[model samples]
Target chain A: MTAAQPATGHDHVVVAADVNGVSVTEPVPTRWTLAQFLRDRLGLTGTKVSCELQVCGACSVLVDGAPVSACTYLAADIDGRRVQTVEGLAARDQLHPLQRSFVEHFALQCGFCTPGFLMMAKALLDRNPDPTEDEVKEYLDGNICRCTGYEPIVAAVLDAAKRMRGQA
Target chain B: MVLPPFALHRPTTTAQALSLLAEDSVPYSGGTELLLAMRMGLIRPTALVDLKRIPEMQEIRTDRSRLLIGAGVSHDRLATDPLVEQHARLLAAAEREVGNARVRAQGSIGGNICFGEPRSDVATVLIALEAELGLANSAGERSVPAEEFFLGPYWTARDATELLTAISIPLPCAEGVYLKFQTVERPTVAVAAVRRPGGDYRVVVGAVGEVPVWADYPGVGEVDPVDLVGRTSPVSDLTGSERYKRHVTEVYIRRAAELLAESER
Candidate 1:
């Protein structure tokens, strides 16, 4: 009784979203999560869904510059909104400052949850270019990393913020 | 996808939304809680009336001493809205104590209160502040005091046909704070206390009872946190034993009261 099978009789919703600067409109199952739409429909596999529940930060994505748990956010509701996934962080040739800093500081081990961390960290830096260590720790209460004791992830975010502000 | 298939209804106005309501229809605010429950197959509503498009329910309007908080306001908005920060600072502080930045960005005050989750920090503060809830339905709009809104965990006075539109908080302008014991998104034991100069004293203890209990605060400068424990009847869950939760509830109450008292001087 716990595992939910899809409700059989349903129509679909048309979702038009600006994903990573590309605009697309597609008919989606009303129940499909934003994470699923990103990974399945658009084939943007960078957004990972580790714990489908919002508990894990593995599926964090930015909707209009605010970090949201994409696994729980419905694709149908994201209409007319801009969604930025980890795939959008980098240009064709250059890595985003956050991505470069993550690589420079070796922030990931399994590399599965890196996208979520990057996007969440991006929002944090956008608001406060220089955050205290405790502030960063508190802001990331929902985004969890099972590897590296989070020291390097914290260091990488600080470094990225410095690089973004041109203070590095 | 974890969520069961359903039709999505987007209505721009409250009356239009009310017209679309049915037994199997559920109102979607931020979809933070609704989507989570839907994914687990716990709730299978046939249709979801998305409330985000309703402009009337999205304003945080300040009229003199009272502030009308739209139910559609996200947790982050409640936490940082300038009017909330200036007028109902304690409620603002409580919003911050909710889930982290990510959760706050998507969770709405309406869902938080309408869902009537006993462990919700916002609910505790609202009860302590003597807040009133604005509920709309096919008939008309009515106001229910925050104290009378909750019946139990996951249960509220608003029927399926009714929608929670806004929350009105009387400007207590009191020195107040909400303190909680938590290891995750929900609090294990939370307490909200407010002390207004030459006005009133109130306290609410939660996460330990069926619904957060509003305790009778003793007069000015007199506080015994242990007194709240008896009123709450702390329930034992994964967080701790019943006795332990009761103890922590007392501790947090003490801390909250101390903060209130210190501000009075």
Candidate 2:
């Protein structure tokens, strides 16, 4: 409820980390989350953050290729680790397979949950390139999409997996 | 959103980590539990000590008869670790069942144990297997039985300066089986059963009590897990009434007992 603290260039020691293939070493506040560090400090606003309350799965990101809720993960924890956000998933202008599939299958109505879903699916497919429909559902058990019903999102993830595995 | 500003220290060695701990220095393991508490104003640490960089504290080794799980091992690693799969499959399964995928990836088994949550699935499984906890401090290292580790909700026997180093489980003589029922973030009730080749069994119930209840069954025929539920007074909070939790606890005990019997066959 108090005023938000100044995010970047704080009076703290720089912790080096790799964010989307970019090695960044900056003085981050000790209390900042990976989501806040990316969106507020690094100017990578593609990583959506929905504050600390609610397990809505809106602030999900990839830390070392693992799907983690960025609302809770400390930025200090990601020091010296690789973080792949929705921004990193795409190479330049070419969309990642999951991003493309989301658009094709109408996975998002408002697109707020798109970034989180894409990053989580990317992590899931990275570990399991060929996940079953049930496996995809299970892998995304934590991720919630209220805008577009789960079936379309699940279908999009399955389609993305197929494309990533070279089957489509 | 703003959190109270604090200094961060990354200690690569156990001795350095121990030296940094004080009344105000909070040692950060996985940050899954601590960060949430900090956000809620439950705890305010002046210094946050990061301990994951220590190599010795991150080793998961197994001997011929027992497996040692480093405190820093993530729940994801525990779910798929070869030694945990072969020696403590019940633990691996419990770890896999603890939370959703993202929580498992970020939370550490040590943080889970040290947090001492009343409805902890990991605590119940560990107590049932009779795992030993390794604690380290500036003084020295000592092993404590899991059954005695948990004192209450969010309370453990660990000293402020001591850090949980590892958890060790012996090879089960029979089978280690655990069953849980949950409709919320925390389980409704969790029961674990360990059997021996000689027919003796160890049963521990979690989430429905102050700590994991290590039960002593009076032989195989005299005491049934279902009947034992009505006899104890378990605290009832958000999950349900005391009576309802007791009912669910009985169900899991019966199912875990059934799995233990099937393991023998």
Candidate 3:
């Protein structure tokens, strides 16, 4: 479901990348953002787009294990890199530990910012398996959550960190 | 917003990149700033010469007493790199907090300087460290002191046909502290105060003004916060009023000096 028919023309560059363990090669418009490529072309709506600037982390995704604002990131730039979106977090019907913690902790009310929060938290945990509360806060500073007041979300990440570290 | 349609060129060498540079063609690295500017309609280059593939621009090394940092190195890499940590620790500390994790991961130090944003933490630190910027064109290469490289807000000394290649910091470099007062995404005022190996001190205050303002002191005791504040004409914007920024700049300069003095003790 990743690779597409090779498009040949100006203003288009073919991008071959790994999306959620699936290899995708598609000809994307040079100006198309990574969020557009994921949501529009690939039908991966788990990644949202807001603010359109890098200010908001609504479209946060990991490129080679580093979080980037997909809204400002060019789709062509994802070529030859491994991209992980929120849609890639689960296995079969089992939710990721961070996902479980979010739900259990009432981390989402509007749910608009969940996917971004999950993805950003995942990036942080992947880098630092055991982040202090302040470290988690600092790492997730770019993201905005209007509904949850951010307290529960921070608690969920801490709880998830312990769960992942086998301390829960 | 979609970027205006433009041809993308991936050049593997500086020569190839230089040949493609023109008034209409721009050197692009992380696209952290350039793409944003393009999408905002502030700039619309007909083509982008991607500099990531140029291997020469990705290196960080030392030549004699100077630390040579390739322009393409990411802020995150610079923050964690042992060489940067050992040589330019102040730059490393500032880079660690520039924007956020995503920005550090994607934005390049060279791109930060080349963009010449008034609120740039990198520019403030480099100016205090007395770093030199390397620029290249089809003709030749030249180095500009970091202080003179930035002309004004979003303006630099780099020509349309030139590309920033590397940053050179003369070693036994100034060691010190960088303090900033930020109420928003960018800093309201950034101050870098450092004592050079020769025992002279420098204080650079940025973010509040169109360009960074600096003053040299033979000794830390001679550093005047009032005189340093007088050198800047801070723009009154959402961050603060001109008078407010001047006050903050003076305070941060004094604080940075105090911290540097304490650390040196």
Candidate 4:
């Protein structure tokens, strides 16, 4: 098969991501990252992209319901896979417990890193609801929060876990 | 920034990928390392042949005596694999410590080994385990031991026409442990040591040299620190001075000895 030239037109790469309980297939660019496809192609820009490199975690999205760096993953790789971005986290008029806890605990100083932190925290708590302080730190080590110290962020995650489990 | 303009080729067979590579097109697996290199202008290829679609290149099965790991298996998969965890615990642990969860999920073992990055944590572990690399081309298939696969800093013994298909790690008679000493938030200096039954050992030190260095331990006698030190000529990079790396290598060797001693007990 002869290789073709790079074109700007949109080619159909089947992406079976669940966007807020809706399974959709879209035609995306061959080189489009999951972050770009979410924001530019699907117009779901709630998942922010700060450092395109995987360092800053600002573009964290749930691939198969696990928090992953969307900026680094190619959209084509997740073909026929389910993806859930921040926009898909909450129900229609009902906020997820982590979202509510972030607002209640003032976990955001600038709100730029909130989505990433929330996604990471959500994934952590989903897997381990009653995580220790050290476990929480280790699990969220990949996330970088430049706005506020991690004290409130950690507290909010813990508090959210308690709230979700009806503990306190 | 957008990825530079390049044609993408999804090759369904290893032969197809090797043919493209023979024509100077780059074969891509994870795209984590190659993408970074392309962005830095270190590698400027006009085409990228994606190898993820190849069925034979994604198998992680085991033979009678060896564990055959496909090149496309991600670090995340390796870390959580039952067979890999049972046979190569140190490798599974090191894979967990690779970059982060994201990189672990996206990066492949083949890409990690084939890239031949000097500072790679998995490369050192593979060398310590005495893994065999399987390479294929239009000519035929060849298996190169991991120790000889890495030639120098970011250099491998791979020919232009070859595509690394799988990595085979021989089941060892010992419990292995990998110890890495990294300065705070960077790559590690020394990586793994395989301590077998009857007190035989193979200590692998990476990031301190151009390629991972393997030293044989005769027996569990009084280990001379000097013997382990200065074995590898480390460079003074931004990570640390050559002197500091040598010192850390000794420290990790002692640490490995203690761990092995406890495991034996």
Candidate 5:
């Protein structure tokens, strides 16, 4: 499954994106962005679309194990790339530690920006298990949260780190 | 919103990608820049050849002599990779400053370099690092040094049928720093400055011109502002005027010199 045969014809592009752990291949318009493809073609709405421009970070999703905004990224460009949205953060009935911490710490108000924040925080903590306040702040700088300010989100991330380390 | 209708092709190999591109198909990677341009209707290609699946273009390997970064390696990976930090820490720092977490995840180094936008932070760092870009076409493979890579704004030496394979960066002497000044907080202005041992310096300024400008100033004897500014062509964009950019470059150069001097001391 590493190399997919190039299908004949160019009318529809075959997208072999591994969303979370699920390998999905679908025919998408050549112009469809990954965000639109996820929301419309694959019916994965967990990856939201807010700022189509690369700014707001509301459309954040993990592409190939790294957080990226899906709005401006084309589905045709992500062939064979692994993508993970907010929907893939949980396992069965148990939410990821970051997700649980967000709820426990009340990190979300309207929750419009929660997914982006969660993804960004997950990216940060995954790379640096014990991130200092400055590191966390620097890492989360791109993810804009208009609600609940930033203290609760930072607290949620810290708490999640503690729980992950068996400290909480 | 949805993308306009167009043809798509996924090329598994670089040769196939080049062939498709030779047939006038637009090669796409990561699509952070291409998609935006498509949305803006700046480019309207009938077919898009996706290069993500090409195995040769996704590797990041470093030897004792040089680091070969695949064109498709994402900014996020570059920013966090231990190897990248060890070899090109300044580049890693600049990678961290690219966009948001999302942009870094989706944006590829090849795409960034080929996009030819003068405001690119990575381009500045690559120029300062004296990176060499590897390009492959149906004909053969050729390497272009970073100093000679960019032709103009949003343009490179790459032909329509050529695919950028890799970028090779020589290992520095464990002494380098990249400092950037952004207009507000979104897009950065001046990008990176690398300081090597023995007072060797490379200063790069981005976003202030049509293409990133590199100046190698080793010591105080070679610090000529007139000669340095004359070599670079700065453009007036929404971010800053040409004069303003030049002024900032001077300020950044002086600041970088001081930082490098302190590091030496």
Candidate 6:
């Protein structure tokens, strides 16, 4: 344990966290959002940012396995926490089950919203590996997809759930 | 849009937190509402005293005849906590539907109350349950009923120097149904009709007005939807016309009462 430092009006604070299984520590602006920290600072551009307001799940990311709106979350607050983004889904040379399911089910059209959808769905599956269609819809209601009519997205999640459970 | 720069402080104790609070240095818990306000330029604070690290602020316990919920507890926790579910089932039901999964995981009950959002499900249910807010400042601590804590939209009874510490609901709290007419993120009209322990009935209508409007009845038959509708001040907005909101307010009030009656059987 270190001695308590005097509180200062410094705009930047050192943030230490495990991002996508990699430990990252850097001085971040007090106002820097988790989205900015992931995209601009760490180059984890897989997380998208739109509708900075939390209404749209375009900026959804997992903080300690719970979904959060990264655009509005302070990067400084991620200290000593774990963050999982879309980039964290794959294990080099292989698409994650969710990503593979999305491709097979054609869950994405424009693909702009795919990362967000994938991440949010992953968060849900992480908690409830087997989800009914209605449960998946309820969980993903906060996320928006302007393509594929959301049916395939729902199907993809169900399929991914089966794959993860060794029933596919 | 980036939030305006502000100094941040993390305090572990209530006394330390109270000493750090000032007019410009505000309590930041969840950032679900405060950070959004900052981005919209609706509020600008020089410093943010982050309260998430406080141990006492995250506890949920029963004290005598009251169920004490820590101010920093998230909506998700409230929805699932055994004590809250057992003692205040209506609150748990309402908590389950607050915002979405992310908001539920991130937003704090204290932040929800302190923000004083008129369309808040938690506030309407708490008011119906007759929950009391525990507040603290450098001078001392105080308690305010949920019904009186919200003065108006984005306005609360809490002083700038005070921080909400816990929400205390009387044990054997009122049990009922919370129904809302929501087509958007926020509810258009939310109604909570509950039968308290003493055989009295309460119906609180919120979101369709500047603040939640409630009434008490001696019996389920005595609950009047028309009278409750007359009390609300629903304004015409994107959700619905004032007349439309009034119509739904009456409808939801009646439906809530009906459901509450059915639950008793």
Across all candidates, the chain A TM-score values are: 0.90, 0.88, 0.92, 0.88, 0.91, 0.93
Model 3 iRMS: 3.1
Which candidate has the top score in TM-score? 6
Instruction: Report the TM-score for the A-chain of model 4.
Output: 0.88
**Candidate 5 lDDT for residue B264:** 64
Q: List the RMSD of every prediction in angstroms.
A: 4.3, 4.4, 2.4, 3.7, 3.3, 1.6
Which residue runs does candidate 6 get wrong by more than 4 Å? A1-9
lDDT of 4 by residue, B1-265 (tens): 5665566667778877777784447778888788777767778777778888888887887798788999999898898899888877888888877876667767899998888888898888888877899998888999999889999987899976688999998865345677787653336586576775456777777878888777777754444446766678788888788888788778887887677667767
Q: Model 4, range A103-129, lDDT digits (tens) per residue?
A: 888888988898898888887877788
Clashes of each: 0, 0, 0, 0, 2, 0
Cα lDDT of model 2 by residue, A1-168, tens digit? 111323222336556788889988777777787788888888888877674642556788887788888888878667667888878888999988888998899888988877877888888888888889988887777766777468989999999888877854
Model 1 spans with C-alpha error above 4 angstroms: A1-10
- For candidate 6, the per-residue lDDT at B8 reads 84
DockQ of each: 0.45, 0.40, 0.52, 0.31, 0.56, 0.70
TM-score for chain B of all predictions? 0.95, 0.93, 0.98, 0.94, 0.91, 0.99
Q: Measured with DockQ on alpha carbons, how good is candidate 1?
A: 0.45
lDDT of each: 0.83, 0.80, 0.90, 0.77, 0.77, 0.91
Task: Using lDDT, give the best candidate's number.
Answer: 6
Q: Give fnat for candidates 1, 2 and onward, in order.
A: 0.64, 0.51, 0.54, 0.16, 0.75, 0.66
Off by over 4 Å in 4: A1-17, A165-168, B183-186, B197-199
Q: Tens digit of lDDT per residue, candidate 2, span B18-91?
A: 88888788778777788888888899988887777788777888877778888988899999988778878888
The TM-score of predicted model 3 comes to 0.97
Interface RMSD of each: 4.2, 4.8, 3.1, 4.4, 2.1, 1.5
- Per-residue error (Å), model 1, residue A160: 1.0
In candidate 4, which residue pairs get closer than 3 Å at backbone N, Cα or C atoms, i.e. clash? none
